[model samples]
Target: MSPLNWGVDSAAIADEELLSCVKNNYGMPDFWGRYLSTVPGASEGLTTNEINFLKSNGIKIMPIYNNFRNTVGKQQGIVAARNAIYRAKRLGIKDGTVLFANIERFFEVDANWLIGWVETMFSSTYRPGYYHDPVQGNFNEAYCQAVAQSELVKNQSILWSAEPQTGVSSKTKIPRFRPQKPDCYATVWAWQYGRNSTECPIDTVLADQKLYNLMY
Candidate 1:
């Protein structure tokens, strides 16, 4: 694992200037978040040029499946996950890719619902992952509990938490990757230390490149 360093992850892909800013102002990002949804800005989605650029620049992509609607039940989870797979495939992302299911803070995570999404996606083209807050213990949360109690969450399913660092400098800075203890899952792959803050150009996280390579 590498030390916590500056990185950016956004639905808005960086232009040349932004990428320059990233390299000059911060540093080369370890990973990035690319939207695989039909959102307004992300509707155009990813391109071969972008993938080539990132790969050539040594940045790994973290594909996001953004279902703007609530996925609170088993049926909804299945539907949303399936749709995410469809969009990913349409974007030329192959099967076995690891996709982070975006669970917004407004959505209440239910045990059965989360499991449904993970299982459906896992059985299909993409490997399943969750981008959510893990309160209390990591695996103790409802989402983790659901996965822990079932066979849906396999060893490959990655967990990315959105827990911001505390007592950091007021000045813009990249927090270190210090995962909380007793996570529901055995390991946490990434931690979002900055969320649309001045700390960086976009939301950012600290992750282990080796773990991230499993999906890519």
Candidate 2:
């Protein structure tokens, strides 16, 4: 396996000044995950200027879609995927990049939703990805069943696991890349090891080098 690369994801908008500060204080991250849609008072989505700034600074982008609270049915999954695609195109995201659907720890995820999400994305220009805690509660059961049933999901989808909460670390003191693995057979592209850092409004991550090929 290639060496894991350090990165960060944030709900707050990382402006030029803030990004500069983050680089100055913390080590430069290989990538930055930003939201695809702007929720009114909750999180800020990426803007053209921010995207340019990040690209200029040599930081790759991981576009995330986090509008849904529950993964209910196939139709809901299709709607979510379509919404994500629309937002991604509007933001000038290139084709073939991975668009991740953020499935929170507390959210309910079902195999139907996962199958629908993967199938919809497989037919689109962009690839499909999911961010979820596989080991949390009974999520693994549903995730495994989805993969077992859909070869498209098992073979084409990329996963980012949010497990083994290892708290935040300093810029110079990044923890080793030891992410908790999912119980099912799947390609885990990245791991969110440290979350909600007090030093910054970001969660630290370590990604498989191969993930770079799917980034925007």
Name the top TM-score candidate: 2
TM-score of 1: 0.81
- Candidate 2's C-alpha runs over 4 A off are 170-172
Would you estimate the TM-scores of all the predictions?
A: 0.81, 0.94
Kindly give the stretch of ten consecutive residues in candidate 1 with the minimal lDDT sum. 165-174
Clashing pairs in 1: 138-183, 138-184, 139-183, 139-184
lDDT of 1 by residue, 1-216 (tens): 654434567766655776776666566776667777647744336566777787788877778888556756788888888888887787677667788887766667677777788788878867888777666333336665675777666455677777655432222465556755224554577777666645445666777665566444
Model 2 scores a TM of 0.94
Q: What RMSD value applies to candidate 2?
A: 1.5
The pairs that clash in candidate 2 are none
Evaluated at residue 169, the lDDT of candidate 2 is: 60
| Candidate 2 lDDT, 176-205, residue by residue in tens | 766665677888889898888777788888
